[model samples]
Target chain A: NAGVTQTPKFRVLKTGQSMTLLCAQDMNHEYMYWYRQDPGMGLRLIHYSVGEGTTAKGEVPDGYNVSRLKKQNFLLGLESAAPSQTSVYFCASSSRWREGVNEQFFGPGTRLTVL
Target chain B: AQSVAQPEDQVNVAEGNPLTVKCTYSVSGNPYLFWYVQYPNRGLQFLLKYITGDNLVKGSYGFEAEFNKSQTSFHLKKPSALVSDSALYFCAVRESTSNTGKLIFGQGTTLQVKP
Candidate 1:
């Protein structure tokens, strides 16, 4: 299986620009998440969906929004780019907690730079 | 609030010698701990997880972590280090009461193995 894949491996944007990141997983997971990785800081959860059509805010969700229109796909959107949002973004998926706190599978990550 | 901490920003070790990565966690109830590794320009990869039963959890790439409830620690260890093992390591924790399976991640620790 391809596991999880992210589109737009690299991007550069100016302030006030907008973009969307695409994440797709073939594992049929029930949960999906978006996170950003900055130097010296570990990955922080941006948003997550418990299932299709359900999304919720996470630890760092101020500049980001997300949607899970399909069970296998999760999308993260930046309404207006900011320098603080420039970081490596990652998407992950995992089974439900009832399945025993399963480890999340991550994508290759998208490197974004906002000027 | 649930949280994880990696006190060391970086750790240097010689190849063929044992290595340990320290991690500590805080949570109200039982904690589900995990370790992940990130190679340069790559997404984070799951290393190991501690849920229940055995205190010593073995994972991919000859890595093992011991869960110490008394100390609220889960330290990653390998019998012998390899230059290839050099990477950034993250420690994460999820509260057992959380149904969404949200994880709190540490700041990450860089492991540098010299030949």
Candidate 2:
């Protein structure tokens, strides 16, 4: 299985530009998550989905939006890119949400640079 | 709210020596804790997690962590350090009360194992 895969491994965007980061998992997972990693900081959650057609905000959901239209895809959108949003973004999926029973599988990550 | 902390910014250990990465967490209810490792320019990999049951939970790459409820600490350990073990370590926590399945992470600790 491909597990989890992300689009645009690296991207450079200007302020106010908009783009969507695509995440797809072939594991038939039930939960999907979006996170950003900044220098010296742990990965901060941005958004997540419990199942298809459901999306929820995470710890740092501002400046971002997400959609999970299909079971295999979760997309994170930046309406207006900002310098603060420039970081490494990762996507993860889990078969379930229960503790001990859930182990997340992560993608290779997408490096975004907002100029 | 759930939060995690990694006291040390970086740890240096020689190859073949024992290594430990400290972590502490705070939560109102029963806490679910996890440890993840991130290699340079790479996404995070799940090292281990403690939900319930045993105090010492073993995980991938010869890594293990001890979950201390009283002390509210979960420290990652490896009997013999390897150069390959040098990377960034993260501690995360989630309150059992919340059903959002969101995780709060620490500021991250860099692990440096020298040969």
Candidate 3:
């Protein structure tokens, strides 16, 4: 089903440079999330969408923005990239709001390095 | 705020031996706990989760976890370890007042299964 896929497996950005990460899922999930994984830090949610045309802030949403204009796609944007934003970013999707039974399906991940 | 703790930084076990990865969490109410595995340079994959019902929850890759509500712990276990089982393990918890279903992850535990 292709499950979840992310564009640009790796990226390097200069400080102040802006960029967008694209995440697409073919599973028709109702929920999508953006998370960053730093060494020793498992994963931290940056933003999420409950459904199309909806977005919400997560635990660490300071430097990131997100949009879910379509049901199968979620995009994360960095207005001004910073060194602190260097990390592996993962995109995930779930069928519904409830977890456990509806565990998330993650993308291969996009590694970003901001200098 | 919900949080997850994976006490051990790393765990090593020989092939054919049983393996255990400890996890604990803190949340206001009932928590939806999850365990995920990540291979080198890859995104996390769902392993199992504990939401309700039985304390013993069985999941993928022949792994199981026992959820202890009183102790507030969910430990992942496998009867026989394999070299393929060597990877990074993450524990996560979901608790939301906004009902976004965002997840908070632990620092991660490295599992090394030697053959």
lDDT of 2 by residue, A38-78 (tens): 88788899999999999988889999999999999999999
Candidate with maximal TM-score: 1
TM-score each candidate: 0.99, 0.96, 0.95
Pairs that collide, model 1: none
Clashing pairs in 3: none
Per-candidate local distance difference test: 0.96, 0.91, 0.91
Estimate the lDDT of model 3: 0.91
**Candidate 1 ranges with C-alpha deviation above 4 Å:** none
Q: Comparing to the true complex, what docking class would candidate 2 get?
A: medium
Q: Candidate 3: misplaced stretches above 4 Å?
A: A98-101, B96-98
lDDT per residue for candidate 3 within A1-115, as digits (tens), equals 9999999899999999999999999998999999999888778889999999999888799989999999999999999999999999999998876543467889999999999
Tell me how far the alpha carbon of residue A35 in candidate 3 is from the true structure, in angstroms, after superposition. Answer: 0.2
> Each candidate's root-mean-square deviation in Å?
0.7, 1.3, 1.6
Q: What is the per-residue lDDT of model 1 for residues B30-76, given as tens digits with 9 covering 90 to 100?
A: 99999999999999899999999999999999999999999999999
Q: How accurate locally is residue B101 in candidate 2, as Cα lDDT from 0 to 100? A: 65
For candidate 1 chain A, the 10 contiguous residues with the lowest summed lDDT are A36-45
